[model samples]
Target: MSARLEVRLDDERKQRLEQLGEAEGVPISEVVRRLIDDAWEEVMRARRIAAVERMAQLEVEDPPDPETLSRELEETYGPGGLS
Candidate 1:
């Protein structure tokens, strides 16, 4: 399903978007969709980075030992399960 949105852009911005669409051989709506998708991807990437940063700040008790993890993985999967 698709949703419809009516945005009111300034003349200059609308003209710029129109020109960009023309140059790219696509409709202005397509241009706007691409811009919105790119912005959404960047926002998701930033959120992932923030999550990693938060996890790094937390202290974990008895995190598994790397050697033990590797050995368990090797037994389950194959030798050098994860090199």
Candidate 2:
């Protein structure tokens, strides 16, 4: 389902949107939709970045030993020895 949206833009912004639409071979509405999609993607990307940053700041207690992790990896992926 699609709903209609009415936005009031200044003359300068309107001209810019028109030029962008012309350059992209699309209508002004298409340009607005693309802009909205781009904005939404940026918001989602920011959320992911924030989540990663939060996780990075966390201190994990009792972390597993590197040697144990290596042994487990080798067990799961098999030895690198030539058969």
Candidate 3:
């Protein structure tokens, strides 16, 4: 139930796609389709992860103490913490 997709590529990109398809033992169209599918899966996975994180953040109960929270923030944003 997939529709046909017509794309215009520069000669160099076309050659590269052909070479990649040959190396992978698949048709160029299949290579493109797989790449697109993989990208879509990655995007969906990221969205799911973000949604879960947002839900967890929303589930927090009482507010953290300011001093403890500041320390935690300093620790998190300090030398050996998440960027």
| Residue pairs with backbone atoms closer than 3 Å in model 1 (clashes) | none
Instruction: Give the per-residue lDDT digits (tens) of candidate 2, residues 1-83.
Output: 99999999999999999999999999999999999999999999999999999999999787569888777777877785232
Go through the candidates in order and give the clash count of each: 0, 0, 0
Error of 3 at 70 (Å): 38
lDDT of 3 by residue, 1-83 (tens): 87998999999999998998999999999989988999999999999999999998885678689878778878879854465
Worst 10 residues of 3 by lDDT: 74-83
lDDT of 3 at 28: 98
Q: Could you tell me which 10 consecutive residues in candidate 2 have the lowest summed lDDT?
A: 74-83
Q: Model 1: how far is 3 from its true place, Å?
A: 2.4
By lDDT rank, best first, the candidates go: 1, 2, 3
Please provide TM-scores, in order, for all candidate models, with all chains considered together.
0.69, 0.73, 0.65
Q: Give candidate 2 misplaced runs (Cα > 4 Å).
A: 65-83
Instruction: List the candidate 1 regions with Cα displacement exceeding 4 Å.
Output: 62-83
Worst 10 residues of 1 by lDDT: 74-83
Candidate rank order under TM-score = 2, 1, 3
